[model samples]
Structures are given as C-alpha cells and as structure tokens.
Target chain A: MEAYNYTDIQCPPPESSEIELCRILYSEDYLTNMGYMRGIMSKNEYSERALALTEKIINVCAAHYTVWEYRYNIIKDGSNHNKIIKDELIWSENIILENPKNYQVWHYRQLLIIELVSKSSDDYNVEKEFELIDKSLIEDSKNYHSWTYRTWLTKHFKLYNDKNLSFINSLLKSDIRNNSAWNFRFFLLVNNPENYIEQDRKSIINGLVLQKELKFTENAIELAPQNQSSWNYLIGIYEKFNLDINNLKGLSLKYSNFEDDKISELEMQPIISSVHALELLARIYSSSKTTVDKAIRAYDLLATKYDPIRVNYWKYLSSSLNTT
Target chain B: MVSLPCSLKVAKDNTAKIYDRNGKYHGKKQYNEGTIDDGELKFHLKKHLNYFRMLLNFLPNAFQSNDPIKMSVIYFNLIGLDLCKGVEEYNNKLFKTKKERSIIIDFIYKHLVESGEGFRGSVNLKLPLVDRSNEMNESLKIVGNYDPANLSQTYFALCILLTLRDESMSQRIDRFQILSYLKRCQLPNGSFKPLLDIYGKPFGENDLRYCLIACSIRKILQIDKIYEIEELKKVDINIENLYEYVLSCTNYEGGFGGEPFDEPQAGLTFCGIAILKLINKLDSKETNSRINYHKLVKWLCQRQIWYNKYNKQELDEGDNGIYDNGGFNGRTNKASDTCYAFWCSASLKLLKLEKLINVKGVELYLLNETQDEILGGFMKNRKSDYCDPLHSCLAVAALKLLDSEYVRELKDIDESLVISKDALNFMEQLKW
Candidate 1:
C-alpha cells in the first residue's frame, strides 16, 4: 500500500513537484465512488456491491473519507451492524500500521468507536479504546492524532482517572523526551476533579497530587536533564504549588555539578542540561536578593558562552533581574 | 462541469493577457535588494514575489488534489502578492499596462458565478473556482431540493472580494441575501457553525474560526458606523450570550480553543481573541473575567522555536545554509509550520505582545527555511517539502507584521481579517 503516485491523479500530467500527492487514485477509487453516488442519490440499499466497493476504497487508503461516509450511510439504511463495524476496525489496524500519521483514518476509527459506544453506552468497554490508542501510539509515539484522540476519548467517556496517569507514565518511561506525553500528563493532572484547589491551608489532596507529580517529573528530569518538556512540567508543578524557587536552588546547582562557593570558575560547564537548569533558576530568582548575584553570573555565562543564540533573553534577565 | 449559469465574463483572453498561456508573467521584474534591516537573513524578497507571480499565472497540476481548499489558496496568493509588494508589481509586459489589478480582481469575482438553495450560485463548498463549485443545484424548479451554502467558503469568498472591495463590486450581487444567509450560520449557543443547508440543516462544526469569519462578515457588510450595535442586537441573537460563549473558549493556559473544552491552538486563539476584539468584548467588564495576558505572552513567545539552537537539521549544501529552529508551531509540541508563523504572529499582534519574540530569529526561520526560493510558495514545515498557497499567503502576512520595510507600500493590515487597512476602509465606505 504505497501512496498513489502523483502522475496517477495529477490534473493533466507530468508536473510532479517535490511533495507527491496520491498516485492516481486507484480504479477502485472510481468504482468505490459509485457507492458514494448511490448513498447521496438516496438509493438507500445495503447492496453487496456498495459494501464491497466501500471495503475496496478503505483497503486502498483508509483515509478515503467519502467512502467511509457512504459506508456509514449504507449501514444506517440496513445491514449486519456489529460485524461490519468490527471488520472496519480490523481493517483500520492495517491502515494505521501503514500510515500512522493519517488523521483521517484515525478519525474514521473514532467515528466507528462512537457508533459502538452510542449503540450500547452502558456496556461499552472504554479500556478497549485506551488499549487501541496505546497500540497506535506504540507505532507512532508522538502522533498528535493519537494523543488528541486519547484526550477526546477520555473526556467523552469520563476515563480521566489514575489509569490515565499510569498510561502517560509508561509513555514517558519509553522516551524521556516525549513532550506530548508530558503535556498530556499535565492536562490530565490539572483537569482532575479530585485534585481540589487550595483552600484554607494547602488542601492535602491537592498537595499530595502536586508532590507526587513533582517527584515523578524530577525523576524524569534526572534521566534526561536537557529535556525541555520535563523542565516545563517541573515549572508547572512549582507554579501549581506556588513553591519558592529557593527550595530547588541546591538541586538545580548539583544537577549541573556546580559547586556553590566556586561560582567564579564558571568555564567548567559543557552539558546543555545545566544551562536550562541555570536559566530556570534565574527566572525563579528574578526578584530574590539572596541568589540574585549568583543568578546574574549564571545569566551572563548563558548569554556569552553557553547558549549565545538566546543571548538577548539571558542578557535581558541579567540586566533586569538585579534591578528588581 | 464548470457552470456558467451567471452572465459574468470568463475572461480567458484576459487571463492570457495576465500571463501568457504558458503562465509566465511575460517579463522579468527586478526588485530592490537593499540590505534587509536585520542583516541576519539569507533570503531574497524579490525572488519570493517572482515565485508567486509565476505560480499564480500557471498553477501546477500537482495542486489539483487541493481542490477543496482552492478558495483559501487564492486568498493566500492574492494577499501574499499584495503583502510581498503591491498588486501593481504582479503585472508584466502584457498584463502590465492593461489594468493588471482588474485581472486579479476579475479572477476573484468569478467565484460568484452561479445559484443554489440559499443563493443564485453556490460559489464553492471547499475547492477552488476552476475545479470547484457545489453544483448540487442550478434551478429552483425542484421545489424541495437545494444545495447548502457552505458558510466557511462563503466567508472566504466575501473576505477575498473585500480585499478588493470597491463601490460597484458591492452592487453586482444580492448583498441582503448574502448578509441574511451569513447570519443564519450562527448557532443558538453564540458560536457559529461552518455551513447551513438550503433546507436549514446546520452542519455542526462550530468553532472560533468560523465565528471570527461571521463576525468579520457582519463588520464588513455593515453600511454605517452609527447604530451598528443596535442593528446587531435587533437580529434574533443574544450578543451578551454570544460574548459569554466566546469567553468560555478561553482556557487558563492564556490561549483560546476552537470550542469550549478544546485544547489551545494558535490559529483558534487568534480567531477567539480577534472575534472578541471585533465585537468589542475583549475589554468589556461584564463578568470581571480577566485574561492573564502576561502568561499568554509567555506561552506565545515560546511557540517560536529556533530549530538551529537544539534540533539536528541535516540538510545538504545550499540546503545546509538556513536552520529551521524557532519557527512557530501552532501548539505546544507540534512541528513548526509556515501557517503558524501567521497564526502565532497575528495572535501576538492582536494581543500586543509580539515585541517579546526575537524579531530577527523569526524572519530567518520563515523567510529562509519554509519559503521555496524557487517555487515562490511556503511549505508547511521543514520535513515535508509540500508547498501550498495557504502557507504562502499567511507566511507573507507574518512577514508584513514582523517588519513592513521589506515589502514596499505594505498596507496597515487589520489583525482580524489579515486584510490591508485600505481594504478595510473601502469596505467601511461601501453602503448597503
């Protein structure tokens, strides 16, 4: 199932540019189109030809959206409901395997899932979808379509529980730089109804969730110190907890093997993680007097030596941080 | 199957005059290569204009699959050409002296060439003028059957026409019918859907994008500044509820979503914020709801990811020259795209926090990397060399806002419509 060659579907011919559209749509595309024509023409019959044609188009390209629509219409008119949908789902597995990034194919899967769920909302196994997405994600880890579908499914089926946290943790374990996983983790955590907002003295439930996340993220950051997603998550937790930057000052320093008293020997830094750690430390210390001077030194190093490209940002921080 | 139900001229000869039948602009025009104020870019501004000029006259058959988004492609080209320089520069040896602007304008007016359930002609549902037109109907003789007027296409149609809106262009079509039809797309929830059929079946893809377009249409179609709010209130819609519905789309992340409970996206963020600004609800103190602009500024500033800084962009010589970092990604963890440059930049401009971004860095990523030095169009990203007119149009709009100096005679553009100030003023001048 290679994509269609451009000459196959080019308007006239032979003017192929860099990005090839589908090779001319398959002859099945033209035949399968008959199904859509039958659907739109309101012929309203689940004819074997219509079913076969729809299957051909789907087999050729799972993203053939019109064929899916026509197939759905024909099913709505008449047919074996469960078997047809289950067959389509099984067919989608091959399509998803071939084209993991096809948003349209995933959308078709989602529409089918919704149909199943609507048919028996009370009995629908939400775990099956979670597993399906988990499988799809295994194929293409950072597939935005898979992640968005996960989020939509979670919200749709009320699957936002500790189970999701474990799923995201598994993803992060595989690739510490899986930023989408990190983002999803944050979204799920923040939107959790159980994680109540701080009331009369740091609500214990909220604090526990924050502390658990903070520890979880700190573990990930230790593994891939230069991972921006981890750092963002750490910052998000710090913001969520309304914790002071001074608390993590020592950890940030040691993560880079920076000796506190020997800051004057600043030329020893080489790892990229230390630079981001230092940058975060500076942002946290924007108004702190005790660490302001050391933060300035770190900023100047980041500006001139370490990450010179964003020197404007580091220099701006160095100049402005001390002023406040 | 291209219909000619309306008596408008096709102007095939005129098109040939615009560019010879082969599609070349007929003559080469040199542009000022004066030092780009930043001096950090390795791109040629003049070449972009030339690239676009050629693409417009002789479109590649490769873009035939993009039939649905054809109107969008047209918008991008015309507006990109406009932003890159001026419409005058689009002329050549033949199209040069003979009202070249009229050729482009006529090309746009051609979308209004047919009838449907809601109007005499359903311009386009999702494709271009040549390869598209929802020709699901032609005559009203069939009493009950009629084709639906796609709201998003109609909005793009009016927005494109208003880019060249003059006095008489308003008279050629039924404005009242168009205006009434546009309003019908609004759902009771205050959000606007993208399509409304002839039998009044609503296609329920309500989002900030369509709502922005609907609001822009209302603003563009209004004849008078006086009592405009009063007229809007008179319609069978709740402006207050509509405003509230819009407010719900805002998330705590300092960004907006397509709908309530949706994730934050740069494009819809602009649509949400801009629609509010258009309807004058952005600053209203109705619910004491304050948007954390500072947090939003931080979020948006971070969207400009400089690929050279960290990621490995392994391109060959000539290709090895420019880095693709810091290009705007529409979301938190997405690839940088040409269109996001516009969406992110437009949102920043509307929010008035655009200055926080490194101006020099953005110029390099957008102009050098995504833009095809040869093709004159912008690709969606570095990985895929797939170029499209939408990307080309928005990328130029982003550039115009980044610095107007590169583009001579750049109009003061409104962030909402992304149309020039003069065009917006022209729309204002038109009476119903």
Candidate 2:
C-alpha cells in the first residue's frame, strides 16, 4: 500500500502504442506497478516492494518470464528463503488455477519447490505439490506443463512407487484414451531411475512387469479396438524390448480380419476393421520374408477401405515392401 | 484368432452438412470432397493480406493482452504476408519509404538485451542504451541481470529480419555473444531453458519447443561454423548433450513430447524431429538406432482424421467431427486443429516422407473448414469464431508446404524455418 518512486528509470512514453494498449487492456494499478517495478529492477532494488510488484504483474500477465525471473532473484536474496518459498508455493497455487496453461507459472513453482527443498527439506511437502498439480490437471487433463511438472516432481523426489502407478491407473480408468496417462505409465515403467539400473533392464523385459503392462494394454485395446494410444503403447512395449512383431500377430488378427490369398478388385471395400490393428498387421507382415504378400494385402485394404485418410502412407508401405 | 467386437464403423452417408465456426448450416457437402471456390478463395487471400497489413501496422484492441510477445506477432504478420506473396503489396501500400522499414527494424533492435546476446519478447523492460564502457560498471550489472533475452524471441527476431530481407542482420547480430548466451541457457541435462534468470542461471521448463528454437537460432547465426574458427568454439552449445536431451524426450509412442516423460504431441514431435534434422544428426546411426522411425511416421500419418459419424463413441468423445474429416489433430483421440496440419505435415516433410499423407485431404480441410470465408485468417477449428496469428500463419505455411493446386497462390515455405522460400534464400545468401 506504499507508493514506490519511479523517477530514477524512464518508462515508455505516454504516446507509445504499448502504453495505449496497456491502458486499454490493463488496470491503472497494473501499469503503475509495472512502471515502478521497471525502476526497481533497473536500480537492482530486490526489496519487499519489488517482490510484491512482481506478484501483481504476474497476476495480470502470468506468461511474462521477466517478471517471474525477477521475483525468483528477489526470493533468493531475501533473508527468510524458506518462508518466502513456502509463501510462493501457496501464492502460485492460485496463479496456476487462474492460468493452468501458463508455462511460467509451472516453472516458477518448480523453482520454488527446488528452493524450498534445498532450504528446509522437512518443509518440502511432495503430497501438497502433487495435489496442486492434480487440481491443475483436473482443469485440463492433458495440460503439458502440469504433466511435465508432475513428472519432474516425481522423478526429483524419487516418488516412483505404487502410489504413482495407481494415480496413472485412475486417470486411465476415467478415460482410457488419455494418451498422457498412457505415456506417463510408459515413463514409470521404462524411464524410472530404478528401472535404469543394469539389472532392472532384464527384469523389465523378462519379468512380470512386462506381462502386467501387456495385459493392461490388451484390455485397453479390447475396450476400444480403434484407440491409437493403446495400440501405440502395445507396439512401443514390444519395440522397446526388441521383441518380435509376430508376437502381436494373434491380437492384431483378432481386430483386423483380412485374407491375403484372395485376389480382389481394387474398388472392393473390405470389412471395417480397427485401422490401428491393420497398420500393426502390416508392420508384422512387412518385417518377415514369407509374409510380404500379406503386408501388401493389408496395406491395399487400408488404402482402399479402413483408413483411406492415410492411403498414400499405406501405398508407400506396400510399394516399399514390394521393392524389398 | 477370435474376432473382437469391431468398434470401427464408417459413416453410411457419403455427405454431411457443412457449418461455419458459428454453427450456421452451409448445406450438405460430400466427405473428402472439400473443394474451394476460386472466387471465394481469392477473396479470402485478399482478406488475409489485409489482416496481415493491419497486424503489422497496429494490432487491434482485441490483441492488446498479447503485448508481451509483440515481436512474435510481428514475425507472424511478416511471414503471413510473405506466404501470401503480399510483401511487395505491403511495401508498396503501407511501408513505401525506406524510413518506414528502418523504423520497424529499429523497433526490433530496441528489444535486444543490453549485452547484445539475444532479444527480449518486448520492450517492457527496456534499458537505457548505455555505452559499452559505461555498462561495464558494477552498478550497471543489473542491465545484464534484468530483461534477459529469450530463446524464442531471439528466433522470432532473426526470422523477422530474414522476412524483411534485412541483409545487414548478420552484422547487427552479435553471433558470438548469442552463442555464449545459448550455451548458458543449456542445462547439464541437455535441454535448453526458454530464458535465463538474474544470476544468468537457466530457468523455465525444459521443453522441445525451446530446443528447436535454440537449434534454429544456431542455424540462423551459423554458429556451427564457429568451431572451425578456434576462437569461437568456446561459445558453441554442447551439441552432443543437446542431442541426448532430444532423444531422451522421445515417448514410446514414437512421437516426441514437450519434455521428458510428457505426452507426445504433434507440435513437440515436430520440434524434436526438426532439431535432429537441423543438427544433421537425424540420419546418424545413433539416431536411427534410438528412434522408431516407422512408428513415428505412422503416428504422424494417423493424425489425419477420417470422420465417421456412425461411430457414436468417437462422436461423443469429440474425436472427429464431420467438418474435420481431412484435418490433422495434435494427439491421439483429439479433435482436428488448424495448426497441427502444419506441425504434422512439416514433420513428415522434414523426414522426406511428406508424400505419405493425403495432401489433397489436407488442402480440403484447410480451405473448406478452418479457412474463414468472410474474414482473412484461418481459425483454430471450425468451432472457433476468430482467427489469431499463430493458427493463421501456420495454416498458410502448411498450405505452402503442401504446394496444393487449390492454393497455388501461396509461395513455397521452408518446412523447418516456416518462412517463405525467398526469405530462406535471402538468409542463406547473407555474408557474415
């Protein structure tokens, strides 16, 4: 509530279009705060007033990285780092809710958490952070920042456990087609630090973990045969382990019914099959010498019927197979 | 193998009702037969040129909130005009005098950081143009601390320079200082932060978007050639670590995410692939071994929507609408968007696999559904009422990349840079 002097540094002239636009879009308080903050920043005045001004500016323009960076510098230089970081954590929760899509808000939160953890390890509450991220994700389940922050949080705190798995499962349970959750699931399985150890690789590929993931993906595929996420996850698992594509031939055949030997007219419409499954089948067939004809047939069917949207891709695949 | 319940069903009707962004019925149109009326298309082009001109001159009150990224908006407007082959018209009509062009150029230069490293998003934190000797004082160190240049803004600045055919851009830009700034922005984990903080520490989410932009800045500045000049090698970013960072962000689904362990998105995937391509590491054995090339292509191809109204579940989920049959979506189970058409198509184009997708279908989607008939720019989707710079610029770039007969008026665009081929040629021909 104290008026800060801004005589030291020059603000944009009143005639500037930026000032005019700011007048139209923002409040007088926002403009005054920004002008004062510019002076404070130029003078290297990392005071409580400067910090407060940054918060005001950030509230109006959450995407401004300059304001966020200045605020971080203020916090780092402040006497009570832990207290200010905790306050920032709480303050940014509201900012995130107001602008969940803003990358700066999430990045600022990450900075606050890092500072909090470094200053007072006991004060770094992982659950609170998770809750905030969950709320943000609830607003937009596929929010890039929220998901990225969540991943960073989990990895940073070494919280890759059953709880994380269950959270991802709950997301998938709500919407099986949530590719974000599916990608997170893959991350937890393959990219976890614990899984990166030399011995864990074998366990991941040959152990019950792979079996469990396969069954989960299979069930998802069965529920929605056309879901590309499930199909992609399934293919990803096999490809990651360097497993044979033929292993998926049976599951793929269940969804894609096509006869390779039967000669058909170019205009004939095939039975409506899962385009994903057909694509998978084509990959499986194309990989083997004996089934090249089958791969061409599947591509032909996809080009003409099931997935005509990517007909050129299919034809390209078929021709490549023929050349080989 | 037992047959599973087939959830995939094609629409029985060959045609569906067309609607504008406001949901006004525009009569029935056959699926996959989105043709543009030449007269209407030409009118739309005129409107687009007018819109670009307006954006470049002065943004309307509606875009007042976008003050922070005014540089990007200018770049979009310039690129949009170039794509429409309206730069000459723009010059002749709006900015006839050399002084006008110089004024615009000076405005951009005003946003450059005092350190001469990079450009700021805006002049909001404009510092006094102090002399270099005076700036070396301890008290003036805050100049370097505050108003740090952003990677994205720097990229946009260079692109704007190229679009404007600023031949002296190389001289104006401090390539070594920018390269040093880029080096500072890179985290030990290999990802580049979008911006730096007061103490020159890299902050912000590690994203492929920033990575791609960093690569672009490096390419535009010709930083790679600095290695041959021994004096400049110290300023170069650690390309090995950057490459590792990119590879680490790849999802099992064969698409790249914005960050590591994030969901694969078309835009980020484009960023990832484009980074590899820019660095000349895309076709390397290490990259080939790591990336699932076929799967990436499949994922990119599958972005094109083949709408089937009979699929009730898909309809309920808003996966694809009748109006979006030929459009591309960013992710799986997402509705088609105008920008993703460029992201997906350009990613494929970078891989020399552009012909794999139905190019005609993309043209149809852009022309008939997202292209605003009455207004100039392209909308995000059929449901959006107004068009913004991002979607409009990308939509035009996508059309240019496709080189479709429907939009032959559009000039060719460099897929990686997303600028007119002429602009790219100008950049390539610049002698530093």
Clashing pairs for model 2 are none
What does the lDDT read for residue A243 in candidate 2? 83
Model 1 Cα lDDT, one tens digit per residue, B1-432: 111111112122222222332444522211112111223344456766776666566565554434334565556666766666545444444255445556555554544524421221212121211321344333422211122444555656666676655345667656555555665667778887555533354443466777787777666666224435666445433456668787777654556766664556788888877877777776667533556665566567656654222222111111211234447767655557778878877887876756555565566567656767675667786555467668877877787777634454455577787777767777777766
Comparing only chain B with the true structure, the TM-scores of all models are 0.75, 0.88
- Encode model 1's per-residue lDDT on A88-163: one tens digit a residue: 7787767776777765576667777888767743575766777777887875687766777777787677676768
User: Tens digits of per-residue lDDT for model 2 on B143-183?
Assistant: 35567888988999899888878867888888888988999
Off by over 4 Å in 2: A1-31, A121-123, A196-206, A259-270, B1-43, B128-143, B309-313, B317-319
* Whole-structure CA lDDT of model 1: 0.57
A158-267 in candidate 2: lDDT tens per residue?
77767778888998998888888888888888766556445555677666778878999999988887787888888888877788888888988887766543434332
Tell me, by TM-score, which candidate is best. Answer: 2
Alpha-carbon lDDT, every model: 0.57, 0.76
What is every candidate's alpha-carbon RMSD to the true fold? 12.2, 5.1
Clash number for every model? 18, 0
| lDDT score for residue A279 of model 2 | 79
Candidate 1 chain B weakest lDDT stretch, 10 residues:
B1-10
